[model samples]
Target: MSFDVICLIAEWAPAVGACRESRGADFYWDAPENPNGEDLPFAIERARRGFDFIEAGFYYEILRRRLPSRVRGKADSFFGSVYHELGPGCPEPPDDLADDVGIELAKHEMYYSMRPTTVRSVLEHARAVPWPEIEHAATSAVMPPRITRHDVRDIEHFRSIVWFHQDWLDEAARTGRGLIVLISQ
Candidate 1:
């Protein structure tokens, strides 16, 4: 019943740095590429090999796994259950990447971008999941104070935050999705 949680480190570098500067082993960083580089593809490729979850603001190849399968005629619908759309102006990842990879990968990207901003929001979302189904909790090593608290809390009122990392190694290991995580060095 272990579920994987992916954190978007590249998108939230400022917040992560702030959290790390303030918090302890609660967060860490491990990126092979210069997150600020101009080449997005190289960044993505390096990320693919290094982490299970990617943190790019723009949707990359790995996120395609998160999308629901679009069969020939069986009510062609996206996997809305786990997929969520971000703000209107947000930059979208390449369509080819999304199409080639699974939509779940996109879902992970969206999740990282839209993680709850408040403790209450996080608590509510975490509580929605049945405890019996969750065996592992994962998140970026660096996160906002509120999100970090939500990912680390052990109270019955909220979902238990089990493990936190900058990559998605835990998620890939659990789901078998060949996704990678991206972060800034």
Candidate 2:
């Protein structure tokens, strides 16, 4: 499965824990129940085991996976992110992009980001990206993006992904704690 990413807090703080609105997650089952019927902790453990199966940061690997050779790099997948926490320590993209099982595992892994500092940096970079201006200009073909040449669909998708991380980072940063990344396929 291809990888989907999320940014989150490193520590589960008391305030965060106390939030009745949400557990800082985009969507999912609650603490006592993970996406699976099992408890969160057990689901997380199982996710970790599944996470250990893939590889990351290899463009050629992506190319090989495509029937028409569509290769998306780590940055491209993260919406032109500068976050480096996702490559080595983070698990690789899954083989089946449609594999919900693998995505669940990745979600658990990224939910508790392993590299909070790096993720923060990535969030900062994403926020700094000129998405708004470029989007407006592109609508008129006035000034195209200079930072990347990804197709319109990829660019748009990446922009949304970056926005998601920006929000997540902002939320976690408020608590003065590091972040965790949740990635699913």
Candidate 3:
């Protein structure tokens, strides 16, 4: 199965919580029915500002290995699993919420997980690594075979995905918004 990494603004916690009340994908797209409940438009705009990177597992693995935990600041050195939080203070979303966003563990090998991190943490981690360094390291990193649904073999393609992630983090820094990291399989 393919892994999709989706980033959403941390401000949408309430909206997310509302939607997650009903498990499965159906609730995620449609806003909750209560008109005065939450600011749907604002949440949507924040989501629009977020990033979605498909099949980036390989590059994630590469960065996870090269980026030392010491410099990760409050951000995770890598993505997380079902049993672990993404990082120290980054707590995993509730089980029902994870299911709603397609991150919950399933019998068909499908799994989804999410963690919230502060804007400062994201900025610290993003600024810690320069773009040129990321590009060079990602391009030169060795990837394990058969680890992902689609393993990226081309260096340019690998660099592009890594760049996309960095750019998203940069945008979050510029906007001064906390981030939610969602990993769906």
Top candidate (lDDT): 3
On TM-score, the stronger of 1 and 3 is: 3
**Model 3: how far residue 104 lies from native, Å:** 8.3
Report how far residue 72 has shifted in candidate 2, in Å. 16
Q: Which is superior by lDDT, 1 or 2?
A: 2
lDDT of 2 by residue, 1-185 (tens): 34444333434342133222353343333445447553332112222211222222222123223312122232333333423334322333221111211233334434334234544565564455444444543344322243333322333543444444566557656645544445566
For each candidate in turn, the TM-score is: 0.20, 0.35, 0.46
Ranking by TM-score: 3, 2, 1
lDDT of 3: 0.44
Quote the lDDT for 168 in model 1. Answer: 34
When summed lDDT is taken over every stretch of 10 residues in candidate 3, the lowest stretch is 43-52
Clashes of 2: 14
* Clash count, candidate 1: 20
Instruction: Kindly list the per-residue Cα lDDT of model 1 for residues 118-184, writing each as its tens digit.
Output: 2223223323433232212212122224432223222231211112321232333333223322223
RMSD, each candidate, Å? 17.4, 12.8, 7.5
